[model samples]
Target: MGLFGILIVASILTYIFRDRLFSRNLETKDDKYNAARKERMEEMDRLLDKINSRGIDSLTPGEKRRLDELSGKK
Candidate 1:
């Protein structure tokens, strides 16, 4: 095949495997740490919203535990 044909094939393969190729094994520790922190913050916000809308007593046992964990009390 010509170089142009090879490039086209490679581009198609890259597009086909993009998700598997790009979704794993490339994160640095800082990236992972930031992602984890963001997740925790989002969860905490959700929990706090629930508490505000209802009351602390509305929290299930598991939710309460997760709150403590996110708050570093656990």
Candidate 2:
């Protein structure tokens, strides 16, 4: 086939296989994102429990900053 025809066929095949080629990568990224989000939620819960039990004044600097960061997003 001519170069133009070959190029067109190659692009068409790439388009057809795009999902099969990339879906796994997309799912992996989604799983990682969900895991990180869940971890953050668990951390926030732990921090809240600490606050309830001991009050805010008992939080360390890092804990205070993390709480502030999470709270500000809300």
lDDT of 1 at 52: 100
What tens digits encode model 2's per-residue C-alpha lDDT throughout 26-63? 46778899998899899999999999999999899999
The candidate maximizing lDDT is 1
Relative to the true structure, how large is the alpha-carbon lDDT of every model?
Answer: 0.97, 0.89
Clashing pairs in 2: none
Off by over 4 Å in 1: 1-25
Error of 1 at 1 (Å): 12
Can you write out model 1's per-residue Cα lDDT over 1-74, one digit (the tens) per residue?
Answer: 99999999999999999998888787899999999999999999999999999999999999999999999999
Assess every candidate by TM-score.
0.65, 0.57
Q: Give the TM-score of candidate 1.
A: 0.65
